[model samples]
Target: MFILSGLFCIPTDWHVLIITFMNAKVESWCARPEQLSDMPVSTWKQLSGQVNQTCQIKNIDWDAVTNETDISGEFGMKDCTKWEYDDSQFQSTIIGDFDLVCGRDVLIDFAQTIYFVGMIFGVLTFGILADILGRKSVLIILLLFACLTGTITSQMPNFTMFAISRVVNAFFIIGIFETHFTYCIELVGGKWSTIIGMGMEYFWVIGWLILALLGYLIRSWRSLTLLISLPSLSAVFMIWLLPESPRWLIAKGKLDQAEKILREAAIMNGKPLPDEWKLKPVKDFENTKKTTIFDLFRTRNMRGKILILYYNFFVTAFLYYGLIFNIGDLGGDVFVNFAASGFLEFPAYGAAIFVLMKCGRRIPYGTSLILSGLFLLSVSFVPRGVYYKDWPCMVLALIGKTCVTFAFGALFVYAAELVPTEIRTSAIGSASFLGRIGGTIAPWVGKLSIYHPYLPVTIFGVNALIAGLVSFLLPETQGQELPYTIEESEKLELASLIAPSILKPAKSTQPMEQEMIEFNNIPEKVEENEEDNLSCYSGDSALSQKVCS
Candidate 1:
């Protein structure tokens, strides 16, 4: 069952990297800029190659445009509208097939931006729906439509059709991925939360590496599109193997359904339930006031957590996606650059796992953000006089990428742990919605590079710096039980920023060590009532035991 949900992360993560590669394809049909110069006739043939063979000849007075823009010594600048593209570079793409070059370049960004716009809708629609509808059912429905719209997007005749279909595809696919994340976390006991969450992120790293390989092998945009979308076919079969989240069912008052799933799980694990054993909703969790989105902001503690976490989500998406979209422009073999960037994430996630367990979530999560921001800012200062300027710049970028990847992997579990169980999906959904706003803005950052190369990284660095500083204010959740209700969440103590953790208790921090000792000294008791029994079977207790072990 642990492996089953891990398998689900592959396709969802692939969708994120796939669209990044898709931008490479769709934007492939850029206008082949022409150099209008007064070079000798014989020099023209020498300078022109396969890329510029199809260039349109335009007669313009060289003196008239001399001060208007910088004209190259080899090729003077000419209007893109009058230029023709080299077909050898791009055989087919939405940009190529529809001749969407020059003035229409924004469409490429539009196509990419709209997907995140759709993701905003997906997060909103599915976040609440996952809570209302069973996570498994809503996920399946989303998967079905994701496959359909993805296929339709591949076959679109024009940019409008492709953009529209992609928007719809993104809406459902992003929803499925986010909902499945919530489902996977809920499916596990809390003890395995970091492992399960980070393990799934490792799959996302694998998906990016796979996309790089596929993008290399499949040159045509449409072919690559279809190849990536093909996995959605397996989503149907995967659906049959998945189970409704018992936690969600319990939350929604579906005890019979929840019990059936739990019993089957127990049977599969060879730990048969007692003959008298019966599962029911926890009494304290029942008849809780109906939660609304406003509930997140209604309380003082929650409002701060919600706002800070929301910004963290935004910063995470901003830095992560911004770095991804800029990879192609980094001056290397696009394929190698993409693959190398993806490769660094493997160790990043591994490091994240280590730090999250040993150092606790708040310090590691915040430190990673700070380090990534510092690295990103430092890239602009790489000495131009160096023999290999590009290498230093790329290394700095990769380091920043690695740090953000580590932060993002841990951020999901951190966010999940901070929010209460009942409204967990909605909280995640809202955070994701804010994250997509940053995602939507990422493509525009690439555009900012034209004004100044460092401008985009500067914006990313600033956001990351703010987010990292704010992370210190968040309560740490490592070695703590997940709260099941708003009241329980409210009772959770805010770990002092300067206080030493149990894992690294300072000499002055006797209170933290004493608290840990007291918590451990508490003896476990057998279930004597329905509520006690429910807590044992609810997965949280099992998770805590796993953590202790």
Candidate 2:
């Protein structure tokens, strides 16, 4: 089920990311008026004195100059109402098809911005629904509609319909990702959660690579959209293949269903459930208070953590998507650059997994963000003469992209571990909700290049630096079990505060080593209890053991 859930990443990621190509700015110039119809394009430019201008044409009467040559003089320029595009690279893009250039250029960014706005609502709404309706149902519903809406997006006859369909598609795309993330995490709750969570990004990278290939091959925005959208219909088969999250079922007091699923899993693994062990409701669930988004903010410690996570998530999305959307401006083949960017993420994710295990969550997460910022800042400083440009800036951007990708993959695991299971989906939803706000702003920020070439990177770099610093304020959840309730999550925050002192050496290194050994045995002691033993099936004990190993 976990592996199958990961497969959905390909289509979901493509749907969300294809916008980078769809709205790409193609080379364009002001169209010649009817009077200049007989003139060659180069002659028209020279005759009208409109060289190097995209949005303006010289306001000169050509009737008097019809028979004249060399009638050159300065003239006032007028904003171009119609444009022609160079279609050598892309046969058609939204920018060309809709004439989204110059004054209308911001609308290109606006389309992506509104898509992310829909993502904000998608995560929040579907997150709560996943928590209530069960993960399987939510995943199936999202997949079906996401595919449908994405296909409709390609058929939209006008910009208004295109934007509307994209918004709806974004809604389902984000929901599919969030719901699947929550489902996969819950399905494999033990030490494997980190691997499962971060590993999901590998599938995303696969989709990204394919997107680059598709974009290069198709060259038309509409066809590319149709190609990416149609394949997602295959994911609808998950209805039968996917199971309801056992952890969620138990939380909702449906023990029979939860037990049946657990038993099936145990049998498949050839580790039969112990007759003595039985399914039990989590003690936190019996209170009947109903988990809401407020539960995340109900306590002081969790509130601080959630807020910091929100900012980190915002920074992650801001820099990550900003860099991706600006691939065309990076001075290379857009397809190659996009593919290279995706390829570099493999190593980044590998490094993220290694550091997450060795350094724990907080240090590596914060450090990656800082490093990503530094690299982005360096991109602006690279000498910009013809001899020292392009490749250097591209190299720096790629490095920054790698670091941010590390942070991006790590943040998912870190955020999932921080929130308790009862409201886990909702909490992640809310964090992503805030993150989408940053994503919404990223396209507009990408447009800042018109003012200054380095302005966008500079802004992204500075924000990443601040966010990196803010990440240290968050508690680390590297070796700890996934919190099952609000109180457990709060206790994690409190424990993180005193953990250093608690493990402080009294005198010799030998004693500290011994203390570490004893500390590692704590879960073993907890496992002796029947109530606590049930956690093994749910993945907590297995996760703790894996972390320690």
Candidate 3:
């Protein structure tokens, strides 16, 4: 409980704080005309004289200019004349407008994206470690490292140091996230999977609220970071409240320990286990064979499927993070912008609850992405001065934001549903890795837009369009029970979906075609071969012979 709550408050702040601080700096730089390029020395002398003349008019001594190098202990002015009476050099920083900095934000944006890239690698590597050692073991290692390294990042003396620390911290925290997702979901039953999965997202909102309150109080970016680290101090105690997942224990062949944990859960829920609830050694462990990373591409459909996943995930991350990081540049007070954004998300969340509960997953998931792309493109050309209303641009930006937000929520659930249990996390994590690169590219995309105003939005719109079309490449998982293995997943016309999408079978769906999509209408069933091949996790392929300890 504490670890989740504590670590939970960290990243949401990371995302919003940088944009807020940088935006302010960018505007301050632009307000002074000194940084403007191409102003001749004669123009400079004129502006300087004009300023000095103002001092004369006011009959007050103009404040004596201080040397910037004297204050910062760097950058000697070898060509002293360069600083002389030059109005263009008068601005204190690089780039004038916050929007221009938004245009130039390649450096900081890459840092942010690379941080998430580290997370994808972390999931893959630590997932293996979690299986080899215990989940609790890996969690402890990652959390301690995360708390230590993550706080140190705030105190980094330079951008390079900060970037390196951020990646290190990203690696650790993501390991914790991957472990926690599987652990918490297992402790409850499979029936509660959606609740456990979706419920955790509320922590993200909690982090945002804390950030808003902290932003109100601290304001300074570094101090806000210090506040984020405060939560980590309480994590050690909070994690002790819940027991390890009973299912994880059973997978390790620890029937006694699994039973103990299950009994404790029953006691907590105030219910008794039925006779069939008793733990027994699973015979499904028979014939468990070794699987490798290469196995993912060995089969014809599998190779093509991986390619499509790579495509889907890459585009998903690119569009999602790009839009999020650049939200302020659409033009507004960032605090108000961030707040309105948070408020707008309520409708998205409400829609998720409604759709997942009543209508099921397929349409809402696909529609969210399709509409997201369309709305974004609609905003792309929203002229600064419309035919009638000048406010049309801002209105379009807000609408684009809402559409993307809803799709962001949809993608998380949608990805979890696509693959059979055999390789779900690996597929998702591998895709996320590519996506993180897209995320890394996002800030640069935003920066590119500073030079080319419509660049980032158009790029984002294109990706959303592709991802929306590719949604059909994935089979609709609505009524089917979560397939526990490749055999089960294949038994459904998995080939049918894959065939349409391949570079061969991936199902690259056009919007109209998605509505016409249908299942093979086979018996609502799990194949016998699939049930017999239960060597992997209930939802992802985390094991070959047995669930790792």
Candidate 4:
């Protein structure tokens, strides 16, 4: 009350002083709301220099004098009868323009969370459809539908309508992300998988850079959303360029189709097929046994491994996205902070490549997770509401962000290697399903900041720590052959856990290539039996047993 009194009651001497200051400035032009649009060319040219000083206010007390008489009386304040907004700012966001202030703020978080709900739905269905229908077709369809829905979202009339449109947009967007990663990796041959995967990953970084630039230039959320999704239209046309996944075709028992795609791929690369390469018709297709989610839990050790990996995936994704969407709470230029944090991802990916190659997967994976956890924990301790608070908080946050990104990159490859080939896709699909669950819950976790500023960051810290601890239990697959079957994977559990160093796969062995060729050459029952007999006579009983098994 005293503060309000001091504010409302200005001394007579100060009033005279303020009038004198106003008299000095009264000779110059002041840009009023009514006068802004009609200003002359010369006035418009000089307005930028004078506007910031006179137009914008650092503090506003909206309730001080709400009535029209009070606005026009001694203070001469602008009347805001229906709507209120500061006209001096360069851009207007959804929250600012729609008045999504204190009472309605949860709508923002809920809107974001609803998008993730769509993503969770997408994650469950897209991978299965991709495996069944074909990667190219699914990707094209997603691109078309996502582009359509995203454009609709931009034109929505209300927050509710906008949030609903985001759900549809998110469904197709997740499909775009998942299907494209799979399609691009399949298009590249085995020797170039790492290079192609890294290249594809760079597209996401470019996306971040583009988003930052667009947000700065296009302040309207509707315009920005449209611009961000416009690239999907281009993707729709890429149907002509993208080929179906040969590996997927082969798994679906379409050997002839797979062969045709691979032959075309070989021709495109200017690499002649091996003189011995032949498209033998596959009779006994191995893909007859359709793996289900239950397959992941059929065995005890496998179940434990899958559960642990899924937990790690969930925690890693939860913390990673929780930090990303909560950037507004850190108190700075949100664009600059988001861009700065996103820019670190490039170096993070590069570092991931280096560390994975030199040190191995587990070291980089576990260490990155632990370091990220520690950094986030440190962020919780930084003194808030003081000078230089943002600097320390931002630094720690960005560092944590980079580490989590690096760990995420490693986790993708590590998870693929941990599971056997027969159910590799299913295992990864399950892990991703869990990850999406975590992502869906992340925005709600971010809202906990309203209760306590430290709560969100502390949750991130705890998740990262838990993920880091669980990652150690995963076996290292560095320099080891990926297991092809359940029995083979079972044989490696003891060795993988006990002495991974003792079992180095021979470089001379081309088991993956051999496996591919062997699957392609599936023969008649009689011929297969004869081949088994020949293999027995040739003293390669283990190979025969493996093939027969």
Best by lDDT: 2
Better of 1 and 2 by lDDT: 2
lDDT head-to-head 1 vs 4, winner: 1
- Please give, for residues 35-102, the per-residue lDDT of candidate 3 as tens digits: 43455544433434433321111112223322221222222221111222212212221112112232
Candidate 4: tens digits of C-alpha lDDT, residues 1-549: 112111111111111111111111111222334434454534432433333333322123433422231332223333222223333332445554445543555565676667767777776577767766877787678776766886797787777787788788777666666666555544432223334445455566655665666566665666665665565666544556555666566545575676666556555555434433334322245544665556667787777778878998898888778777664455557567546655778998888876665565666788899999999999888899774657888788888988888887778767655765444455566677788788879867876889999898899888898888777666655544445455545543422323454333223132322112222322212222354233211121222223231
Residue 311 Cα positional deviation in candidate 4, in Å, after optimal superposition: 1.0
Question: Which residue pairs show backbone clashes in model 2?
Answer: 190-543, 191-543
Error of 4 at 521 (Å): 22
Better of 2 and 3 by TM-score: 2
Alpha-carbon lDDT, every model: 0.69, 0.76, 0.52, 0.57
> Residue 426 deviation, candidate 4, in Å?
4.9
Model 2, range 1-549, lDDT digits (tens) per residue?
A: 666677765788888778778977678878866666767778777666667777787776545556454666777887877888888888889998888888887788788789998898898999999888988898888888877998898888888989999889988889888888888777654346677778888888888898888888899999888888887788767767777887677667787887677667656655555555565566645556887779888878888888988888888998888887774465567788678777888999888777776667777888899998999999788767665447778877878888899998999898988887778888899899988998888867877889998999999999989998877767766656666667767875633433463232112111111111112222222244454444332222532332221
Task: Tell me the spans in candidate 1 whose CA falls farther than 4 Å from its real position.
Answer: 25-56, 59-90, 284-287, 327-332, 493-549
Cα deviation of 44 in candidate 4 (Å)? 24
On a 0 to 1 TM-score scale, where does candidate 2 land against the true structure?
0.84
For model 1, state the Cα shift of residue 71 in Å. Answer: 24
The order by descending TM-score is 2, 1, 4, 3
Give the lDDT of residue 16 in candidate 3.
34
